[model samples]
Target: MIHGCRAIKRADCFHSKGHRNPCRSSSNPYMILFGAVEIAFSQIPDFDQIWWLSIVAAAMSFTYATIGLSLGIAQTVANGGFRGSLTGVSVAAGVSPAQKVWRSLQAFGDISFAYSYAYILIEIQDTIRAPPPSEAAVMKRATMVSVATTTFFYMMCGCLGYAAFGAAAPDNLLTGFGFYEPFWLLDVANAAIVVHLVGAYQVFVQPLFAFVEARAAARWPGSRFLAREVRVGPFALSVFRLTWRTAFVCLTTVAAMLLPFFGDVVGLLGAISFWPLTVYFPVEMYIKQHGVRRWSTRWVCLQTLSAACFLVSVAGAVGSTAGVVGAVKLHRPFSGY
Candidate 1:
């Protein structure tokens, strides 16, 4: 099944790149870079061991959540109470109903951005064992549990952090805690985040590797470089793979060095991709797959919801773009951390 899928993907890649070798197509630098990064990361020992790395990543995530929740609650208590902390927090004396609604929509959009991987579950399903139709059911339950747990932590952190710092809350809750004081704890939390992202970076990039490699194999079927492999002690490595992957990693590393403001870029990407990937595509696919009546009450409601989500996504994209532009203007390119 996997081989068949790869064949189809290779064909698609070849068609998209025309008669020219995909590896030689300089037009799609982003695709090449993305593929290279994925392959490069895949070769890393930690990331290659998925189960062990996932456990470590989960531990780091839990540690950060626990620390954030505890500190937020403690700070809120020290501020007298939630009510007391809310005092003198608002910059505006009055806001119109429309403005309030807009703010609420923006908040929803921001939070919903985190749920944009709904379609990726389908990709994950391919990894499930054969002859178990219940795999989908199991995955659904697991997803629900995961989402519930994440939501609980996020709500606790956001509410308690706001109760503690109110309008003065830093964009990153951890940053609100003075870096120099409680320095060890801060260092640990930051280290955990870095560790988590290392694993996450590979997970996100693997599909790109598959996409690119399949195309390259199809385009250069007779190339000896693609077929040739060299033994490196315990591991058998391909020179073609190594060269492209290293180049890809270099490209990404250079880009990161040039623009290190991670949060802004993440917000911009979330805003731009969130609606189509998460809300609209899944809902539409589900409705169609289930043979639901077009424009029926339930279908209409779902469609309406998708439309609303699209609007929210658009608003978020505009807001994030503006924020990026403002930050760029203030700091200038390559000036921000």
Candidate 2:
């Protein structure tokens, strides 16, 4: 996963320079340095062995929280006083309240998909050591707590950010902040975000790696790829693991390079998958597994909600796809070259 991220970064650099061939002479030195760095990162022990990833994740979250607070305060001060306003900082003079409300709702729909980590929690359920019943209860409580905490911080940042920059706010709050006074603080915040994303990428991708490797091993039991295993201290690293993971990384890196607009891709994915993965499936599964009666209020409400989510997902998916197409048209492949 780290290797893939590095590859993406390298590709982005080449893309930025309008270079048709990423391996051109001008990039060779940087490529060598990146390769060395990737090797060092890959050598780090697995999460189970080192357990420092969680700590890093925690620190990253804290850093983000700090950034939100700082930006909110700065924006508020710049706007005039802390008016505790939830409406954006600079509303157009002629726009009606109805228009503002509609815009706010649209923004909410666009961003609500960003926090679909409920499915991710399900993927990592095995990490919980308790018995089935106890584990389920623990996970339920943890999910509730996590959702509440995240919602609080998200609301704080959104409200504060809007209050600060109002109608003039950029899509990215950090970018909107720009190189104002104390630019170094913005640099630190961005660095923290990069570190956070590295850990997040690994967390999300590991399950896919496991699933693919398991399938390959099942299909080709006698292949050298499945047979060769080396003991690296306490970790049993296999040849197949190294090869397939590298391949996976390369595939993702190439994809990212081909579509370098990060926000558009994320929007497309979130729009297409968020409803089914985050809301519809979970709600329907719970109703079915728990044997909720078809006519019951809970069942009816859940089904209605699922249907609504499906409609929203379809709309969001269409909008996001259009956005991507527009971006592609605006920025042609190797246009920088």
Candidate 3:
């Protein structure tokens, strides 16, 4: 529409040789998503196909997430083994888990999955460090309760999605909520989740940062990098080099995972990885390294409580993994691509 707008200066192109920006990019994915939605609605006569399409899409999503995550885990564990292997195969397979986690989550299948040991470590760093057995016990319980609440919320959201738009998934998923229920309330809920998404993205970034910084520190043991101080043009900057782009990548990756559901991805990922990385690995590693001494009743109780949480979390992960795997196998080839 702006193309036709003129103050009789058509010859004076906006790019008059000094400044030019043919801004073709649209910052809003929701616009593109809704446009396709309008087209789909036009092309279809009714909403009868909603459930079938949903089942297929959801299955595809489920499969991609678990396989991607497990494969990623395999790669991480593999690297932990052959960190210094000399073979070319080792050289080529030496891609670190940091990039892998982001790239894997970016995949359509694993779009909702984000699990890295680094992520887990950052998640429970403070909790794991608590010296008090009771403190650790509370942390474990909190995580359990959080997961349960998130799952229940996602279940409700799934029902809402199914009802509002049938099997039709939208990039702006919450749009359907406005259609099926109260639009105002859905908008508020939607806003709240976007805020939470930002928080979750921070969770992802810490691990990515750690992975990069660890490599840098290894390469430059006594040099100025990562945590070292550095001088800049007008001020000092941390060698960490953390910037808005890094934060954006982390948040956007997570935001992308959430496109089809706007929120279910959070619950799914939380269920799958939150425990394995945070509680299971930390406790097991700590115990294996430090030995779970029967030094004090409090310590014993902490270990026992953590153990119970780990068991339940493992169940959740296994159940989710199976669902994802089975869903992928059941899906028709080329579906949800």
lDDT, candidate 1, 1-337, per-residue tens: 1111222333344445543533221213333343354555576533234656667767888887787788788777777887324333443636455544444444544675666666456645666677556877878887999899889998888888777777656556763331122445655665566566665666555556666778999999999998888888989877777777677766765565455445556666777778888888889888989988987998999999999888878877766665556567665444323
| Tens digit of per-residue lDDT, candidate 3, span 205-294 | 444454565677799887754555556566555535434234445454334423423223443565566556655666667766766666
Candidate 3, position 133, lDDT: 63
- Return whichever of 1 and 2 wins on TM-score: 1
Estimate, for each residue in 141-177, the C-alpha lDDT of model 2 and write its tens digit: 8888877887777778777766676555555565333
For each candidate, give its TM-score against the true structure.
0.77, 0.76, 0.40
Candidate 1 wrongly placed segments (more than 4 Å): 1-40, 44-49, 83-89, 92-110, 131-133, 176-181
- Using TM-score, give the best candidate's number: 1
All models, RMSD in angstroms: 13.6, 7.0, 20.5
Give the higher-lDDT candidate: 2 or 3. Answer: 2
- Report the candidate with higher TM-score, 2 versus 3: 2
175 in model 3: Cα distance from truth in Å?
Answer: 3.9
User: Quick one: ranking by lDDT, best first?
Assistant: 1, 2, 3
lDDT against true structure, model 2? 0.61
